[model samples]
Target: MTPGLPMPVPAPGLPARVRIHEVGARDGLQNEQTVIPTEIKAEFVRRLAAAGLDTVEATSFVHPKWVPQLADAERLFPAVRDLAPEVRLPVLVPNERGLDRALTLGADRIAVFGSATESFAKANLNRTVDEALATFAPVVARAKEAGAHVRGYLSMCFGDPWEGPVPVPQVVRVCRALLDQGCDELSLGDTIGVATPGHVTALLTALNEAGVPTDVLGVHFHDTYGQALANTLAALQHGVTTVDASTGGLGGCPYAKSATGNLATEDLVWMLRGLGIETGVDLERLTATSVWMAERLGRPSPSRTVRALSASLGSPDSLDSHKE
Candidate 1:
């Protein structure tokens, strides 16, 4: 057994493997007020891929006016795209124009962000819920026609700041619409991080009962209330195989004021490794990657696993050269 890794406990009823959909590059950096250089962002994607995170969200094609941080999507995409086929580098496409931009850049995995409530729709996309769905419809269709894997992200699945706890049925409706619109899978977002274990299970049950298959669902939890891992355990219990995480808990909802950092990838890997679930992630290397990133951002990593491992390893002297 590795020094920092856990003993293999092999939890029963959990899947033998879970795919960690890494979002540290795009979703992680999108909300940054300080614009990181395009090369640095590209290098971040490369380092993440080198750390054994096979599915990394590279960047978004959302207009620069909306998200200045990701305005370099075109340059960043090409820089890390060669890692694709081996690594699934998914990009966020905001609308048809965004889709066109991504398609031209050879982005084979594309994601569309949607809101489960009206207020967020207005705030984020400047449209109503249905209007946002309608906009995504053509993008999904075109992506499918282009032989791309489409992931639909439904935000505010648990609770909304302006509208309190959201109904499961409302989320299910939007999820069904996205799937119907040709999304290969759906990622349910706990945007406000207000979900408990019971709420997590209940919503998964509701979506399943509404004819959504478990195999095609993913969970994206925020750690605002420190319930992310607990909520993730609930998700895993429900047979969810796809988990979205940001390295070092690097992101938040820029549009949603009350939202916080995403569930940290290093933390998730530690917990999953303890359970003996195969994620094909190297905890040591991933921790180093996080530490390097933390230094680049001039702060300590928020991920407990990263902090613990860094301390145990006596501060990774270098993250400058990530092994290929």
Candidate 2:
């Protein structure tokens, strides 16, 4: 038995398929009050992979002091590191030491987090925007040297709480700097969840004008103002194929209290399926994973799709086949 799917209606000017960059394990759970067990995190990764997420960002290699929730990065990566070769399990690395730890664990898919604005850079990394980029330079270099694919994450690209509306040129400059530093691709983060469709298009246009091809760009939006999916569609219209999301709508930035959860993977899948934009995700299987995770987290999932399916299907037993 499967959950209901939207009627497929092909959209013009969109990619035939999009690579959903699942960030639930790292970005989703980082702000939780309680720490999720290592085994549970591993199981989540397994379930997501089984549900057909090609790239599941596994965990972060930052100091435990900064994010105690994912302190088990050392333990968690190994547990899920042996997933199918086609499945890409990327991990976030904060600096050279973090990169060292990830490389030691055979994590070839690495992402370095940065900020497009000075305020967020200071608040999140305690460095200016330039300082943060400078810090990431060596990490990106070493990872690339080791034949690892590097993704650069620039947060607060659309808007910043302290700085207000971020200029398009400012974001374009930082994006170029990251690519120039040898990043394989870039994910523009609407960290505070304030971006609208116009702002999203503007950034993509500016980046393209700056020579950052749409193919090397990914969009990471939050649903704070109910604009994540809209912003995603704008990026899609611009020819971006990599979209970042968390399962079950499970996370928010610990630094930006106003920031809500990452774009829910289940929600993204539903829209993609409806638009006839393939994402290779099994919505029922993905929803089951969310249900299972919700039970573990002791809270109901915030994803509209997950909630609806779980309510209509009304049986956890039915979702078991998809669970890992």
Candidate 3:
């Protein structure tokens, strides 16, 4: 662990194995200014899976006007169609149109985005909170009926950029709507990274009280305020076994300038290893992959673990030094 970082306490109820849902390919690259080639994007997903990320979010089917970086989703998905059977590729479907695109491409796993606050719902999806849930209702149902596993993403669950602190009850209601709509799992997103450990506990407690199973919950946090890993530990203590992280902390919210990037996979792996949590991700290979991808992005990774490991190995190019 890095010096001065808080040690993760081993809570009794914590799960033995945690599933790290790699979102670097989709969430991480969506905000990039440069247009990455479709082949490169496909290769990035392959390398992430090679680093032992079993579940990788491939790309979003949203319109090019909304997220142009992921416009090549149609071309990208087919490039990775033959990956190992254990590797599950999920694509983001913003609406019914996006869901239609994903289904046409034969995506077995799809995700929909929703918001807990009215402000974010309006800004992000141009709908009210209730309206956004209503939009996702049939989308989730139709996807589930097609034998596709649907994952629901509730953004701004903890704090919204426009609306200050979001109430736990509001988040629970949206969560229930998604789950009741046939979403197999729900990922609570700290969109602006304003969540703290106490807030995480409070939200999870309320969700549990509302009868939302922890086993079907995942936590997605941004490292904007640098509280993501700490907040993740709180969620795990509360029995959340699934986490969402970007490979090199690659992407941030284009809507929120203050939002930096998603929690770094290497950083999360560092903490999970210290806590003796099994993520099935190889830390060394993960760091190397992030560094390699960072080079392609023409920038250094935002992950402390990636930077530290790169320095320890005497340069980013020396990625093979740590290979077994």
lDDT of 2 by residue, 1-324 (tens): 455689999988899999999999899999888988999999999999999999999999999999999999999999999989999999999999999999999999999999999999999999999999999889999999999999999999989999999999999999999999999999999988899988888889888888989999999998887789988988898899999999988896454443446898998999999999988899999999999998898777777788778766674522333433
Residue 143, model 3: lDDT of: 96
**lDDT, residue 47, candidate 3:** 91
TM per model? 0.94, 0.94, 0.92
Sliding window of 10 residues with minimal summed lDDT for model 1:
315-324
Q: Name the better of 1 and 2 by lDDT.
A: 2
Evaluated with lDDT, which candidate comes out highest? 2
Q: In model 1, what are the clashing residue pairs, if there are any?
A: none
What digit string (tens of lDDT, one per residue) describes model 1 on residues 36-118? 99988888888888888889999999999999999888888888888646899999999999999999999999999999999
The positional error of residue 255 in candidate 3, measured at the CA in angstroms, is 11
Error of 1 at 268 (Å): 0.3
The sequence of per-residue lDDT tens digits that candidate 3 reaches over residues 96-149 is 999999999889999999999999999989999899888988899899989999
Positional deviation of residue 137's Cα in model 1 after best superposition, in angstroms: 0.8
Off by over 4 Å in 1: 1-3, 253-260, 316-324
Q: lDDT of model 1 at residue 127?
A: 99
What are the lDDT figures for the candidates, one per model? Answer: 0.89, 0.90, 0.88
